[model samples]
Target: MEPNNEKSIGVQLTWPIKQSSRVPTPATPQAEDQKIEQGSSKKRKTSDIWNHFTKIKDGATTKAICLNCSATLSAQSNAGTNHLWRHYHRCKSEPRQSVLVPRNSQSLPELIRPPKFNQEAMQECLVEMIVAHQYPFSMVEHRSFREFISALQPKFKMIDQATLQTECMNLYKKRKAVISKQFDDHPSKIALTLEHWSSLDTSSFLKISAHYINPQWKLISRTIAFRLLPPPVDANVIVECITDVLEDWKLLNKCGSITAESSNSNDLAVNKICEMLKERQLLKSTDDYFHVRCAAGAMKEIVQEAFKTTQEAISKLRRIVHLVTATEASKASLQEVAGNCGLPSNKLPSRDILSRWDSTYSMISDALNFQLAFEYLQATQPEYLDCPTALEWLQLKTLKEALEVFHESVSSLSKTDLPSANRSYLNMKKIERHLSKPEHYENNHSINIICPMANAFQKYWARLREFSEIASVLDPRLKLQYLQFSLVKQHGVLVAGEKLTISKNRLICPTIPQLRV
Candidate 1:
C-alpha cells in the first residue's frame, strides 16, 4: 500500500472503555454467637452486644441500673425498662423505665382540663363542631362567604414575604397541554355571550370556585376567612370578629324579607319555584323558554337565590372542613363557626375534606349499611362484585351502602325530628314496597332491583296528605303547614302533627302507632 502519511499521522483509532467511579463493597459476614460474646468485645457489654434489653426487672429481682444507658430496674418497683417495652414504640423517644397509667384511673390522676382556657380547651369546640348532632355551616355558613368578602380589605399596601407567600400559596398551578398562559374553558351547549361583566352573576359553578379561590380571602387561624373589615391589628383576633360578621349576615338575610307583601305573602320567590316544580308545565315553560336572551342570567339568579339555603349549607360544610387540619388554638376558632351552625362536634372523620365528611356523616347509617353489604358480598357472591370494573363495583357498592345508611339513619333520626325523618323514611318505604320485600334488608342488592330513589320530601308530603293528623304533630322546623311522609302498603301517606298518625289507606278506622296501658 502507498505510504499514506495522512493515515499514519492520524491519532490511534480505538474504542475507549469507560468505567463507573463506584467502589465495590464486599458483603458483611454474619455475626457468630462466640464472636458476639464478652472478653474481646468487653467494652460493649454482653447485653449491649446483642442488645438483650437494657435491664431486667424479674418483678422480684435485685435493684439494678443499665449503665449502657440511663434505664433503671428495681425488684419491688414496676417502673422498669421491661415494663416500658410495651409502650416504647409509641413513646417517641429512647427506651426508658416506664410506669403503667390506667386509661381511666381516677385516683392517681393523669391529666384534667382547666376551667375555661387550656391547650385542649381550645379543641373542645372544634371536636364538637366536627361531630355535632347537626352541621351548622351547611345551614347558615354560606351567608358568611358573601359577608366576609364584603368585609375584608385586601392588604396590598404592605405585602410581607409571608403574606405574599400566603396569597400565592392558594394559587392553583394549571398547565395547558401546549404550555400556554391562557386557560380554555369549554362552553356549555346553550352558550349565551354576555355584553357586560355584570351580565354574568354568580352561577352555581362560580359559587363553588369562590368558596376556595378568592384573592381577597385569608386564613384566620387556618380557617379561610375572607378579609372582612381589612386585616385587623391582630391576626389572632379573627375568629370572634368573623363570627360576628357572619351572624350579622344571617340576621340581615332573613327569610322573612324575601317575599312581597301580597295576599300570598307566605310565598317567597324560592318557595314559588318549589311549588312550580310540582307543576312541571309552568316550571319548564318559564325555565326552558322565558326570554332565551336573558335565560342564562335569569337561570343563574334563580338557581343561586332559590337554593340559597342549599348553597349556603354546602359552603358551611366546606369551611368546617378547611380548619380540620389546624392547631388546637385554631380548632377552637373553627368550633365557633360550627357552633353558629348545627353540626357534629367530635370524633371528626379522617377523610378528604370536611364538607364531604359532613355530607358523609349526614348519611352515616348509609355508610355503615354499605360496609355491611361489602362484607356480605365478600362472604357470598364476591364474583358478582368482581365482575364489574373496580370503579363500577365501587360505585354500585357505594350506592347500595348509601341506601342502607339512609334507611338506618332515618329510623334513628325519626324519633327526634319526626317530620324530617318521617319524610326520609317514607321514601325508603316506597322503594321497599315497590322493589323490595316487607324487610328491605332481604335481597336489596339484587342485580335486578334498580329503581330511582323517591325524594324524601315528596314521599313525606304524600304521607302527610294520607294522615292529616301527622301534620299536627310535625315539628315547626319541617314547615308543617303542609308536611308529609309515605307509608307502607297501598297508595297513601302518614302525616305529622302534635299527634302523629297515618292519614290515607284502605283501613277505614285509621290510627297512628299507639302505646296503651
Candidate 2:
C-alpha cells in the first residue's frame, strides 16, 4: 500500500511537468540585451540610456521603447544609443530628484519640526470639556467659538451640533462601561446615597450614587443612576426605581447601607430594600441600623428652625441689604462708604432666598461685616432707617457665633476623603456643648432665642443611628472609652452604662466581625 501511494504521488507531480514542456523560440540580440539591462537595474553596465529604454522587436526590425513617455525609437546596432540619451534627457514625464551637497553655495534652510496635531485627540478633549462643563452642543457651531478654535489651530475641523452630540454620547457610554466593570470587580459591600432633585420646569430626577473602598484603600464614589421619576413619586415608586437600579447594576445583594435625606418616603424605601436583601440572605443588620441620614440635610433643618425665631432682626437686615442694592447709584454709595470704613468693598450687600438659611446666614454675615457703613448711611440719609438697634446687633452677633458652629460641623462632614460616620458623633457633641453653654446667652431675649435653637438641634441629634455610635468607637482617637465618657456626659451614668455595654457586645460579636477601623 505504501509503494502504491508513492507511485500515485509521483504520477500527479509529473503531469504538470509534461504539460509545461514547449519548444524554445529564438530571440534577437537587442531583446537579449534589454533583458540583461532590466535584470541589472541595481548595478548599471553599458550605456545609462538603457535604464530608461527597453529593446523590442517590431516585425523584422528592432526598436527602443521609452519607459517614461512610452515613445519608440530605432534600436539597430548601426544606429548608436545617442538618440536614446537625448530623448531621455528631454522626457517630460520623468521625475526629478534635487540633492543637497555641502560647499559654500546657497543652501536650503534646515527643516524644523512643527508640533504634531491629532484630530481625534482634539475631538476627545472637546467632548470631555462639553461633558464636564455642561456646555450646550451648539457651542461648537457658534461662530465666535469656531473662530477662536481656528485661531488656536487652523487644521482642526469643527464638528456640527449633531456630530458633537454623538461624540458626547459615545464618551458617556465608554466611561459608563468602565465604571460598570469597576463595580463588577469590586469585592467589598457597596454603600449607596440617593437624592431627589427638581429643575425649574418641575421635572424631578433621582440621582443614585455608589460608594465603596477599592482594593487599594481609596474611597470611590460614582453616580450609577440619574433617572426621571414620574408623577406621584411615592414610597412604592421610589423603592421600585431603586430596586431596578440595583438589579440593573448587579449590586442588589452586595449593597450594605443606604444614605438619604430624612423623609418618610426614603424611610419606607429603605425598609423595602432591606426586605429584598434579607430574602436573598444578604442583610446581616436590621433596616434601622442600615439607614444613614444625610448629616448636611439634618443641619439644614436645624438652621432653618433657628432662623424662624430670629426673623424680626433678619427682616430688618434683609430690608437694609435690599435698599443698598436697589440701584447702581446706591451700590456705588455703599461701596464708597464701605471703603471709608476700612472694610472690604467687595463684600457688598447680598440678597438671600427664603428657603435657604445658608444664604440668610450669608446676608447676615455681610450685613454685620459692613455694620459701620450701614450706620454711616443711616446718619447721612433719612431714607436709610432700616439699620437695627444696638441690642438687635448684639443678638445678631450671638446668633452668628452659634450658627458658625453648625456651619463648621457640616463643612467637616461634607468632606469625602475622611470617614464621615465616625466624626459625625464628635461634631454633634461639639454642637451640643455650644448649645448648652450659658455664657453664650447674655439676656432674656438671647435665652429665648437660643432655647428654640437648642431644641431644634437636639431633635435631629437624638435620631442619629447606632451606626454612628459604633463608628465613633472604631475611631482610634475616640475609642470605646471616649464613647463611654460621651454617653455618660449626655445620658446619666445608668443609661450610659447600658448603652456602652451594648456597643461593646456588638464590637465583640463573632457574626459581625466585618466592622474594623
Candidate 3:
C-alpha cells in the first residue's frame, strides 16, 4: 500500500518527461570545455606520436616540443593534435641535429650514439697485439693479461691459447699472401740479406730479409723467411735454404744480391750463388760480385779481436761493476757516493758479456762515467776494493773513447731503414781514420790500444765488398768524391785512383746484375 504512493510519485515524475514542457537545465560551457580538454589529453597520452615530444605549458598556451630537433609547436586541446603529428613526421624526415656546447654549458643535452660492441673486431685486435709484440701464444692464458682484457671489456670473450694460435697463423698466412703478391708485382729486383746464427740452445736459425725500393722510391726491408736451418749448414745447404726462400717468395728470378758473414761456408755459398746466377743468365757479366759481405759482422769481428788486447783492464772494470752491483747495499753505496761526488746517482755500471762488444762498450762508458764514485767507494768502503786505479781509469777512458767511435760506426751501419750496404764504405773509412790518427800512436799507452785496434781493423776490414763500394758511389750526395776520399784515406792517393779506375771499369763491364739501389 505504501509503495503505491511512491509509484504514483514516480509516475508523475515520468509524466513530466520534460522533452518539451520544461526548460532543460542549461549546460555549463566551462564544464563542457573541461570535458573536451580531458578527452583530448587522454587521446594525446594514448597516441604513439606523443612519445617523441614533451608537453609543457608556455604561460597559458600548451606546447609540444620535439626531443630530437628541440622544436616547439602548439599542443592546446582545441589546436587538434593533427598539426603536432604532422610536425613530428616532418622533423623526423631530416637528420637529427647535433649541438656542440661549451665546457661549462647548460644547454640542450648532447645526443651521443654509443659505438656498438663488435666481438669479432675485438678478437682481431687481440690477435694483432700478440703478433706485433712477439708474445707467445700462451700469453692468452696469463692471468694478469686476461684480467686486464676482461676489465677493459667484460663483453669480449677470452680466447684460449689454442684459438689465439690458430688466429695468429691465419693472420700470418693472410699477410704472407699479401706480401707475396706485392713482391710479384714489384718492378725492381730484390736484394736479400741472409743472417744465420745459432741460439744459446744450439738451435740454428736463418733469417732472410728482402730489400727493395717501392714504386714510390721508398726503401723497404722486410723479413721474408725465418725458419730452422737444419744440421750440416754448409755451402750447399745454405744455398738450398736461400733458394727455397726465394722461390717461396717468388723472388728467385728477382734476386739481386745475398749478403752474409765473411766465413768459409758463406764464401762458398756466395760462389755457388754466383755460379747459379750465371747459369740462369741472371748475371750481367762473369764475377762472384752478387755476394755482399756483412759489414756489421765484420765490424763485430774487429771489435772482438780488439777486445783481446784490453781483456786484463776489462776484467778489472768488470770486477768493479761486480763489486758495486753485487748487492743492494753495494748499489746504494755506489749511488750515495755518486750523489756526493756531484754525479747522477742513476749512472750505474753495466755488466759486459764476453761475446758482445757492444755490451763491453756500454760497460766501459758507464764505468768511466762513475769513476769518481768508484774511487770514493774504494776509499770509504773497506769491502769495495776493486776500484780501477787512476791510471787504469784513464786507460779505460781512452779505451771508451776509442771504442765509442767503433760503437757509433757499427750502430750507423747496422741501421735497416735503408740498405746498409751503401753506407759500409763510409763507416769503414771512419773507423780507419779514427784508428790511424797519428796522435793516437804518440803515447805508449795509446800505442798499446791503437796498435791492436788497427791490426784487428785491417784483418777484418781488409777487403771491402765491390758491391758496397759501388753502392756508395751510386749515392747522389756522395757519388765518386766520397768514395775517392774514403779510398785515399785508407790506400793513399795513388792506390785510391787505381781503385776508382777499377770500380768504374767494373761498373762499365757490368759484373753484377739486378743491382739494388
Candidate 1 lDDT tens digits, 1-517: 2122333432222211123233211111122223334576545222111131243556557544433344554523334233333222233333222434333334343455222334333333333443345443332235554355335423212223343334333331221122111112211111111111111332111010001111332211111123332232232232233334324332211111111111121123234432333254322322211111121122122222212323333333333334343457645543444444444434432323331232433433232323333333335543323222334334444344434534443445335422221243334344345434443334444222222233332333342333323322333444333334322224344323222332322122322221000
- Measured against the true structure, the TM-scores of the candidates, in listed sequence, are 0.17, 0.71, 0.72
**Each candidate: how many clashes?**
47, 0, 0
For model 1, state the Cα shift of residue 388 in Å.
Answer: 39
Worst-scoring 10-residue span by lDDT in model 1 = 204-213
lDDT of 2 by residue, 303-408 (tens): 7766777778888888989988999999999999989989899878699987567777778877898988888988999878778877787778777877988878
lDDT of 3 by residue, 1-517 (tens): 0112312221121111112344222123333334444753454223444556679998999998876578888888777555655564456432422222233333324564334589999999999988898988888888998899999899989999889879889988989998888888887778888787678988888888888888887887889888787886778888888878877877867887777878898889877877887788876555545777788888877766656767677888898787777889888878887888998877688788766789889989887778788777788777657666777777777788888887898777556467456788778778888888888878877777778778877766656657667877777888889878877977999999999899888777654445764
RMSD of each: 30.3, 12.7, 14.6
Best-to-worst lDDT order = 2, 3, 1
lDDT (CA) per prediction: 0.30, 0.76, 0.74
After superposition, which runs of candidate 2 have C-alpha atoms over 4 Å from their true positions? 1-122, 143-158, 285-287, 336-346, 379-382, 389-391, 485-498, 509-517
Report the Cα lDDT for candidate 1: 0.30
What is the Cα-based lDDT of residue 285 in candidate 1?
27
Error of 1 at 8 (Å): 23
